[model samples]
Target: MEQSHQALSSKSEAFIEKENKYGAHNYHPLPVVLEKGEGVYVWDVDGKKYYDFLSAYSAVNQGHCHPKIVGAMVKQAQTLTLTSRAFYNDQLGPYEEFVTEYFGFDKVLPMNTGAEAVETALKICRKWAYEVKGIPENQAQIIVCENNFHGRTTTIISFSNDENARKSFGPFTAGFIKIPYDDIEALENALKSTNNIAGFLVEPIQGEAGVYVPADGYLAKAKALCEQYNALFIADEVQTGIARTGKLLAVHHENVQPDILILGKAISGGVYPVSAVLANNAVMNVIKPGQHGSTFGGNPVAAAVAIAALEVVRDENLSQNAAYLGVVLRTGLNEIASRNPLITLVRGKGLLNAIVINCDEDSDLAWDICMKFSEYGLLAKPTHGNKIRLAPPLVITETQIHECLGIIERALNDFR
Candidate 1:
């Protein structure tokens, strides 16, 4: 059995080689072939271990292969997995109730990916504009932020200002107004001037845009403005929600509740693809039957998995854990940044943090630092070019955090 396992590992490497040779060149990942993962760590195909600082882009916030989440998945799979919305399932209602209550929403529309959730929100906003807000059809506008990384769908990418994401993806979807992030004035100006606006969609913290956190009170003021204008406030917390940002949701930091909440990634604790669009009945009921849905959306297995995943966050107090350790990790990084000229800035909240490299966006400096981090047994990824996002699982312990910090410090010194 041991020899057969070794042969399987060798075959996996060969498969990876074939993938690089044949697959689309869309993603330029680091040269590490991960084979297995546990809490806060992953082992490469070569049996080398590394701390997982990226946390699967904050998908594995409950840590990799959490036994509870996986166990739920196993039990459900053995019993029942998929029952499309065409028929009622036993798991969907209970899971919906659990998730809606967890996030303080009245209803939830399930989807399979972050982009689908964003797309769902957009559709809901537009429908609500016409039906609820009495806006003319095809004239409802949604406000977005500059440098926002919502998702990669055609309609979602249409509002993206990133050239790589937007180039040649036209003629784009209309009805979106773009504003600078962290600037309340721009949002206020847009909101004041626009009458047919349906909603304001934003990432509380721009995760894929290198973890750009908005200014203090930005969300609070923005939600207020949306209320004043009678427009829906849609928050794309797909990357920052489910306790990734110390709070159950990032908007909680400002005591703001969005009208429409988009959640994904860690909602399944990295066990499955489960995303949801949450809102009150007023906004959600705008979409009657046959308006929007996915074949796999709200499947029995996804519902079951998401309920267990969210329960873990509450039971384990992962939000409080992230809050405490985030300060420690950011402080450590900031201290290191002060001493290193190569590191221009270190900024983030909770477990979602990033270090900006003092080099060109296209430079390999960030990649070099990541490789060095791997050598020191910590794994992370570079977003954009010269920025590396450090988002460990919220389940990580303080001792593990310090150990990871030691690895990061060594990587910084070694890179120098």
Candidate 2:
């Protein structure tokens, strides 16, 4: 039996090998097998070390295997793992309090993933449209942006302008309007044209769509428009919040508070899956008992882990770190861009930044540069085709930033 178990383990590794060979070829990921991680670095299956720059789509803002978050997870698991909404657990209330107070919201609805939180926000907006705004039942509309990426869910992808994400995923969900991002006039025109609009859903900086940063005052202007039209301004900060973008939330950079805030990724410091929707009573109260929920949402383990994760963001001053390091990284990249025509632009706020490669979208240029980066001991992935997003863990130190910069410079030089 023991020999059979060993054979099964070998089969497991072979299974991973075979799956990659014959599985759905959706993602073109960098060829690196991660086995373990700590702080701002990950080791491959071969035990080679590399600095993690993408942070699992900014999910590891607290770095990998954060001790406090892991401790909370372990302790909570020992006590109780899950008690569905059929009954309450002790951890939910305190977690709700911590997250709401931290983000300056009246209440929070926890979920297991960023996409679920986004769907919850949509439901809340629709319900509020019916109950509060008196928009006829199913005619309510939500405004989304061009190149905005909410998630992979059917309804979320319905509004996506990216052909790849939306192509084979329909008959899509309806009742959404798409506008040019960072353009206030487009948003105003949509608002003026529609009366049944319930919300404006946006990413402060469109992360998956190549780390696109909107124009200055774009968020504030949109917020004002939403207020004037009595529509909810929903910010999908799953990638831009929790100090990934200098501020705790990127909307705060413009002094604009979203009515419905969706967060995930780093909520549990990347130790576990945790996501949430934050809003005041007027919007959140629309979701009553049995209206919306997840079996593992706000489970004791997730709640405890998320609480510790948020505390780490505060006690460690990760926001400040991101802000400072962002300046250093951006300035460094700008200097490099001055010498290399291959780099068209370096743009972002805080640590959420990207470099636009001046090459054909379908060419191997971006992928080649990524390989060069991997060789230099830093890991980053290209978005779309000609853009590479760089978002290291918020816990990265100045020395680490400089070291990573050296690696990036070397890779850029190789590209040249």
Top TM-score hit = 1
**TM-score of every prediction relative to native:** 0.96, 0.95
lDDT of each: 0.90, 0.91
Alpha carbon lDDT at 296, candidate 2: 94
Candidate 2 at residue 168, lDDT? 70
Which regions of candidate 1 are displaced past 4 Å?
1-13
- The weakest ten consecutive residues by lDDT in model 2 span 1-10
Off by over 4 Å in 2: 1-16, 21-24
